[model samples]
Target: MPTVDFTLRWPDGRQQRCTSPSTVIHEHFVDGQEMPVPELVARMRVAMHAASERVRARYGFACTGAAEQLEQIEAVAARYGGDAGPVTVVAVGKPAVPEVPRAS
Candidate 1:
């Protein structure tokens, strides 16, 4: 049950922090091996996109800024240390992807 915490900064100077269960991480690293920074960042981006989709579907609002905001994504922490109170920081930034209409 590993979790990834991240921060997303909007164009309007507003920031949103979110944590989500990392299925990709869990499925790939069930043996508790330390994940590479690049892989972690990629998985995080996928998670963020999924999250954004969920929010848009639930609220019926377009997340036009989400793609741009993802450029400012920061992987704050990953809690994979089991019972050791250890946290790993994999700070990475991803390039902005093309914006797509959320309303379907």
Candidate 2:
């Protein structure tokens, strides 16, 4: 299954990757006008933190698949800060191969 990815940026022109790739309600609708850069960055930070916290709370400090995902997410967050536009959610792992039919 595919998971959500998030990229956030701070006002100091810093970026960070979410510690986990999960969906978080960080989107906001604005009228016909440019969104304040600071506000937008703040929203992303909140969203990333919320999602990260939820994941950690659900799964303690364990080495599960989700845990690995979280580490990746954090790396992303750290790199992009909290101002990155919509974080791209990419599918991890190799593609599956179709099975061939065999005669009985």
Q: Which stretches of candidate 1 lie over 4 Å from their true place?
A: 1-33, 62-69, 74-104
Poorest stretch of ten by lDDT in candidate 1: 86-95
TM-score of each: 0.36, 0.36
Residue 96 miss distance in model 1 (angstroms)? 26
Model 2, 12-40: lDDT tens digits are 44544333334443232212223344444
After TM-score superposition, the amount by which residue 65's alpha carbon in candidate 1 deviates from its true location, in angstroms, is 7.2
The lDDT per prediction is 0.42, 0.42
Root-mean-square deviation per candidate: 13.5, 8.7
Model 1 / residue 74 / CA error / Å: 6.4
| Candidate 2 residue-wise lDDT at 83 | 49
* Per-residue lDDT over 1-104 for candidate 1, one digit per residue giving the tens place of the 0 to 100 score: 23344443333334455444332322322222334444545665775566556556766753444444445444332322223232233222232244678996
Candidate 2 positional error at 70, Å: 13
Per-residue lDDT, model 1, residue 63, is 49
